[model samples]
Target: MPLAVGPYGQSQPSCFVKMGFVMGCAVGMAAGALFGTFSCLRIGMRSRELMGGIGKTMMQSGGTFSTYMAIGMDIRC
Candidate 1:
């Protein structure tokens, strides 16, 4: 059951989409942070570059994850 109808017959499909997006974003950001840190270190990035690289990596990963997650959950529903 993807949805639970209310007494008034309202369907709230956004709930599942939101849930997937939030969860995926969190997971992706964490993974990105870990991998980005190691990658930047391996590349011998200075402190300034390290922070910027990590931030960029995190945003890219988060967006990718969230988009796929939202679409997947929507399809599952």
Candidate 2:
């Protein structure tokens, strides 16, 4: 197969790491949202606190998962 060329005409590696990061972020955010919502509800959190907690959980989980997935993909490559 021919190598992929970038806009500057330089050969570029495949997008496996990028894809892994995106997929991991999406999955992690979804999981986080579900768990965060339930945990907040169980704790009786309301309004701003509930929303803030969930958002924080989602961001942390997404970033953590994406970083790990990207590293794994880089290693595989």
Top-lDDT structure, candidate number: 2
lDDT of 2: 0.89
Residues 1-77, candidate 1: write the lDDT tens digits.
45767789997657888899988899889889999999989999988999999999998898899889988988987
Best by TM-score: 1
Model 1: residues with Cα > 4 Å off, grouped in runs: 1-13
Candidate 2 residue pairs in backbone clash: none
Q: Which 10 residues in a row give candidate 2 its minimum summed lDDT? A: 11-20
RMSD (Å) per prediction: 3.6, 2.4
* TM-score to true structure, per model: 0.80, 0.79
RMSD of 1: 3.6
True lDDT of residue 65, candidate 1: 93
Global lDDT for candidate 1?
0.88
